[model samples]
Target: MKDEAFDPVRKLVAPGTTVIWRNTGSADHVVDSVQFHDTADQWQFRTQTLRSGDSVVYAFDQEGIYEYYCGLQGEEMCGVILVGDVSLSNSLPCE
Candidate 1:
């Protein structure tokens, strides 16, 4: 259950779209807000420890860039989500 690399780092969705974070990795991960540094407003969402098969979903209602990390260094698991009319992404597969 490990495909942490060689995939889309993050996804941008439109407002009202639900973004799901599915952890298929063998290792446990904390899907928190890139360390929550000062940018409290930016850290609008987070997830509990997600192990293999575990998942989290977030519905975007605002337009902005949301950054996230896997709470692990070296691995440098970082991603960015741009919400808005950014080409009307449908990859989220959620309403």
Candidate 2:
């Protein structure tokens, strides 16, 4: 994830899968799990400000849609993770 974009922007994964975001930009950034209209209190998770080369990982243990964005950039830098029924083998469909 960067200042104004998330690579791939959207992802689909199995429950219990772990996702990672690596900061490659010069500025700081954050991964916030909340929609644009919701209050800060409604967010499920938020990462600390990540400087260049920093990385964050999260596990999706439930089936549903997870909306996330860079709190600093708001809607301009956002993404979604779609967690659905998948094999326990933990391999992504593309693999």
Candidate with maximal lDDT: 2
lDDT of 2 by residue, 1-95 (tens): 76568886768898899999999888789988874332212348899998899999999888866777788876678777777842222222212
Residue-wise C-alpha lDDT for candidate 1, range 38-61, written one tens digit per residue:
321365556677787888888878
lDDT of each: 0.58, 0.72
Looking at model 1, which ten-residue stretch has the lowest summed lDDT? 86-95
Model 1 bad stretches (over 4 Å): 1-6, 35-41, 73-75, 86-95
The CA root-mean-square deviation of candidate 1, after full C-alpha superposition on the true structure, stands at 7.1
Clashes of each: 0, 0
TM-score of 1: 0.69
